[model samples]
Target: MIAIAIKNLSYHYPDRTPALLDINLQVKRGLKTAILGMNGSGKTTLLYHLNGVIPVESGEVQVFGTPVVKERITEVRRMVGLLFDNPDNQLFSTTLRNDIAFGPRNLRLEPALVHRKVEEAMQLLSIEDLADRPPYCLSLGQKKRAAIAGLISMEPQVLVFDEPFSGLDPALGRQFRELLDELVSGGCTLVYSTHDVDLAYAWADEVVLMHSGRVLKSGPVDLLCDEKTMMRANLPVPLLGRLFQGWNEKPRTLEEALNLMGSTGLAKGKRLQA
Candidate 1:
């Protein structure tokens, strides 16, 4: 199933500055897809159109085969849950529990179901201990998880994140990757935008590179390994990609990379201890 489809999509702000130009994309169901671009390259603008957060100005966007029009906007939003780059923009409830519960409750779910969803989302994100805390008082990383919990609580089929790991430390970033793995295992389609070429290279099944409000390229993760494409997109080749170039094999995680390096004696050196 195609989770999202876009054709000739273009958008501009009220001031007439173009944000997206002739963008075309199709995201498949249950894949971890990443949109890679430099800042102001239309990554967020394209994401906003996915969930109907911003109206489609000159073309069409369809979520699960339904056109994103006024009559179907509600349905589109229900199917696509978007997480902003800033957690503060999405979180507004007094308590963590309330914030996570907001989405399910707004869906008019049964009270018991809403409660269950809130609990489940918190547990999934390991934020149960933060249930009583106010979002305003939480750290940047905590608030990011809380915002994600709120979206997952709604049980949307597709989750869209704009710079989801911007404020996380290395440890939290690893945990976030684990959370995404669990989400994909549970059949959620994950679409995210990132300026981190390393993360995009390692995590995405498919990648889309945008430049100047247009898509420069879109294909499998191998697209990132293309020197010309990465240079054209102004993205550097990821460390692993550079290291493994022409090797016909790539490790997907740090542990895998370390293990591979160890087995191949790539980590050994004349000055290093055996």
Candidate 2:
């Protein structure tokens, strides 16, 4: 089923020009979709509409079959969780534990249930050790995970990340990818706005490419990364994807590509994997 649908969406900041125009998007439940664009191409604006953080200025936005309006704001918020680009902007509590528990507490769930949620989220993000420390005391990576833990405490059906892959080192990026896989395995829909064409192609089941506030392409990852579409969409071809293209292979995971490369001696004398 469609978890979120945006039809012919148009929006503009009150003091600025249009940020998005003639946009159309559909996100399926329990799947991972990436909204990809260069900076200032309305990816974040589209994410706001999906999370119901901003009112739709024109066209229509539906969350779980309900139109996002004044009355359905709470429901929309409950159905979708947004993780901001900067963790400091989102994590405000004095202690990390309290911050993670904030959302369920606000929902008035039982204390025991709230505690369970916080523990689970902390474990998922591997931030359980930072539970009692203040958010500001944590490192950049820990703070990001804590902020995400806070959002996960609410148990929203749809999870949206605004550049989750940003500022993370290779190790932390791998951790976050594992966390996303677990979330999707548990039937949560995931959407992320990003400029990392490589990560978008690697992690997203489906990709939506935006240019100048309009969709240049939207389809399964394979089709989105096709040479013609990547060129026409003005996106750099991911190295792994480019290798897949040149070899005309259907390998899915990075490990498969590694195994293939070793067997075929493709990277024997080159800096291919690195």
Candidate 3:
């Protein structure tokens, strides 16, 4: 299923500066898609259009075959949950539980059902321990998780994130990745924008490279291996891509790379004995 489709999409700022120019794209359902671009490349602008946060000046956007028009804006938002680059923008309630519960409550669900949804979201994020703490006092990583829980509570079919790992340490980043994996395993379509080429290369099932408010290229993660495309997008070649350039086999993570090296060494030792 086509989860999202953008056609001839263009947007501009209040001063008439173009933010997105004639963009066309389609995202498949249940795929982990990474939008790769540098700062000021219109990544966030495109994301805003996904959830109707920004009005579409010209062109059309469809979520699950429903056109994103004024009449359907509310429905679009309900289908696509967005997480801002900064967690503070989304975490406004005092307590963590309140913050996560805010969405379902607004939907006017029954009190008991809202409570159940909030608890389930917190557990899914493994943030049950922080339920009683104030969102304002939580660490950056914790705040991000809480912000995600807030969206999860909404039960949106698709989740969109902007620069999700901006301030996370390696350990916390791994945790976030695991959370994302769980979401996808549960049939959620995931879309996120990032400038980190390495992470995009290693993590995404599909990649879209944007430059100067236009999509330069979009295809499978192997697109990152094209040095010319990476250079054109002003992105550095991912380390693993550069290391295993000509080899048909590529390792997507550190553990896989280590295993590949060990296997290669063992094969070489056997060859020497023969």
**Estimated TM-score per prediction?**
0.94, 0.91, 0.93
Cα-lDDT of candidate 3: 0.91
The digit string of per-residue lDDT tens for model 2 on 143-234 reads 98888888988988999899987777789789888978888999999999888877776788998988778888888877655777677767
lDDT score for residue 184 of model 2: 92
List residue ranges in candidate 3 displaced over 4 A.
Answer: 266-274
lDDT of 3 by residue, 140-187 (tens): 989988998899899898999999888877887888798788888888
Local accuracy by lDDT, each model? 0.90, 0.85, 0.91
Q: List model 1 lDDT by residue over 146-204, tens digit each.
A: 99999989888999999999998888788878988888888899999998888887889
| Candidate scoring better on lDDT of 1 and 2 | 1
Better of 2 and 3 by TM-score: 3
Best-to-worst lDDT order: 3, 1, 2
Q: For model 2, what is the C-alpha lDDT against the true structure?
A: 0.85
Those runs of model 2 whose alpha carbons end farther than 4 Å from true positions after fitting are 262-274
